[model samples]
Target chain A: MKNHVQWESSLFELIRRTSVDLPCDIEQGLRRACKTEKKSSRARWILEALLENVQKARDNDAPLCQDTGSLIFYFQVPVGFDTNALASATRLAVARATRLGYLRQNTIDSVSGSACATNVAYGAPTFYFEQCARGTVDVRLLMKGGGCENVGKQYSLPAESLGAGRDLEGVRRCVLDAVVSAQGNGCAPGILGVCIGGDRATGYECSKSQFLRKLDDKSPVKILARLEDRLLKESKVLEIGPMGLGGNTALLGLKIGSMSRVPASFFVTVSYMCWAFRRRGAVLTVRGGFKKWLY
Target chain B: MALLKPRRLEYPFTPEQVGSLRAGQFVLVSGLVYTARDRIHKYFFDGGKSPVDLKNAALYHCGPVVIRKDSDWVVRAAGPTTSIREEPYLPRIIKDHGVRVIIGKGSMGKVTEGACKAGGCVYLHAVGGAAQVLAEKVVSVKGLYFGEEFGLAEAMWVLELKDFPAIVAIDSKGHNLLRRVKSASLRMGRKLMKSSDPFIP
Candidate 1:
């Protein structure tokens, strides 16, 4: 109800920015990966092409990828914030963005198999709301492509086939298996977010949530950090470079998170993120105006 | 090995043009092509036919982001989608449509590869997620089919392209560059699991 117009405007900008602009951290990560690839290699060519595409998309104010994938919004708001008003504003912004060509007509009706060009269906633009101690409001947008989403895998523990147990070794094997299976299909040189243990649904949720962390940030859990570093190194050996062209890089980085699970269950979920990695965040005032952007 | 400069191929793409190429070769493709993804493929495979012609034609696995301004349609992002999803329909599509060139991201399965070899067709792997850059090459929207039923991503959109960049992943000689990547990665994965290092946790 408060500053409704401002909310829609700021949210639309955020949606547009998330679609067009490649975050600086992910861009830097790509640059670092590009340098590691030998010049004139197929991998090198692919990476160069990706970087050029990034620049072109940013300069032209175009959507980074045609997929424009799932529009996932995560919000941190003050207590007593108008959740309904903000949700309605976000929906309007998404619809306007779709019409303006910032978003593709991506949402499909499951039952009718119809395209919702407006991109506002029952749960098309998935939103997550959490109240924080601070008074500020913040929303993050992740436009994940379908290609990468399709390759995300969830594994159960004590598998004899992969020689994986209910330990970190099992998790490691599962992640490596996922990377290999995905190959170039999911768009290689992907950033992986791994969740160690949880229920089937929550396992995936925790894994995907790990992507919210910056590419350069380190996991606070020491053991998980070690696993992340280890996987990042092993991935390089796989030679699944940019677009799975067989190069010096296989992964940008790996972030691993663990959850307490019931004694009977152990689930490992791997969320594969392509090089596009289109995500952007904005910090807003209570009055619903943009204060600054967050990577 | 060094990457080769792209081989330039124009419209009216033919089996002879596909025969000249090998796996791992990059090429700049130009000409008119039909865009189809999962739904359109299913429709075609299930005996559905449209006005679009496919004799010696190119098939692009893409779901482009398009916007209509005035009477003209504008393509915003036109990048490749993952190709393997259409594996079941690919062989038949090629055989039935007389499709000479298949363009998409990633590689196809063994069945699709065999179809390419038998059909004298080539699979060109486009840059995945490079939508805007790829769309820049789309000079015009020639036509659209099944927009109402199949929706945007699944509808068949005819596109005229100029110098669209892609690499040959499968060729008429049954050569596949992606297979090498696959085997090597599988080998490396086996080695990682067999390593002496203890689990991090």
Candidate 2:
């Protein structure tokens, strides 16, 4: 038997914090971007208003955005831990959170298109569990919004269009195309996660997983770190600005990761996350107490 | 073109009131606004009558977070959804409802622009992703329709609004701010793509 009660309560708190609180690093990035823009520009004004909204939501303990988004949980556990128990606990916690209004009832039945008020419909609250050498259980949650999700793109490289080849240059073109296409629709000041090589589904998954890294963290690979910096600087030139109004600062952060691929295929997937990037995690001890908080 | 000053207007606006709004201007709307998304729009397209009067009313494109209190419904977070998704049905909705103002984010398409001109309606762009701040303007929920069927997010929420701020993204005169941004950004992207800067394709 597992500690259902304690785990449920802790997961509820995690959901609450993830929905209401803006992570410190992302907040800092917004503040920095706000300073560099023209004082009277729309980008600056939008950032200012957003920072205020963040404060208001936190102070009032209210959800930061109306679209609480699809709740996705990523769990890493010790080899011998029971994955089924953890998944069940997560479902119960999601249900409780929906009832308590910590999260909006976002899950729906795809076929029937009915609102599953419990937010625990089939395949809802997507879970990814993996076994690791560590003894502690680490769970991360990300609230992926629909608008941004709609804008995510995948490119099969070595293409004649845009004169892109199956190279790092091709990846750069693919990501830029996505940012340009999204314009103001995906909500500006977007954070992007780019995966250079993988199959279609796994490529998108890997791209979204890159969002777990802190906004300022540098990629261990020198070339990828350089690409991240370059893309971050170049995306501003698109001038999509905040809310798609004309100004500076189109993107706040860009994370790049790559995986090995078959010689015949070169795939690049780009995942866009809106400014309201709600993501948080915690390490839970067996007793269900928070061992530590992860950004 | 000169920038128009932001205006404040109440519900039941006339064609003249809508004509006065130009793209790039701001507006603060007060009074009652009806909320509907994908499903409710389809409902209207399928010949379903609007539960409430929409004559010269502001139609908001949103799926709000509403919770039922003791007996009343409270809007916890009321932010605008992307407007482009409703492009196929907007022209008809504007014509049928006699809607003067359509509030949403991400400016609609050419069809909507033409409809706004023909129907004498204006597209008001709300701040995207600012649900809590937007919810503050929703004073109260008058009532709700389709909650049991389409779910809370897709239901038609009748809300009483006070000083709801938005920008005139597309005006009755056919000017569109979002279109301008998109074209300008595309041009810039092309220019950047052609450059010899190693990152460019």
Winner by DockQ: 1
Q: Per-residue lDDT for B100-195 in model 2, tens only?
A: 889999857899999999998999988888888889999989888888888888998898899887878899987898899989889987777777
Residue range A133-218, candidate 1, lDDT tens digits: 88899898888888999999999898788999988888888998998998978787788989989899889888888889999988
Q: Per-prediction DockQ scores?
A: 0.77, 0.58
* Candidate 1, B87-180: lDDT as tens digits: 9998888888889999998857789889998999999999999987899999999999888788877889999999999889988887888888
Summarize candidate 2's per-residue lDDT along A148-210 as a digit string, tens digits.
999999999876777778888878878878889999888888899999888998999999999
Scoring only the A-chain of each prediction against the true A-chain gives TM-scores of 0.98, 0.98
True contacts kept of each: 0.87, 0.63
Interface RMSD of 1: 1.5
lDDT, model 2 = 0.86
Error of 1 at A135 (Å): 1.1
- Looking at model 1 chain A, which ten-residue stretch has the lowest summed lDDT? A244-253
Pairs of residues clashing in candidate 2? none
Which pairs clash in model 1? none
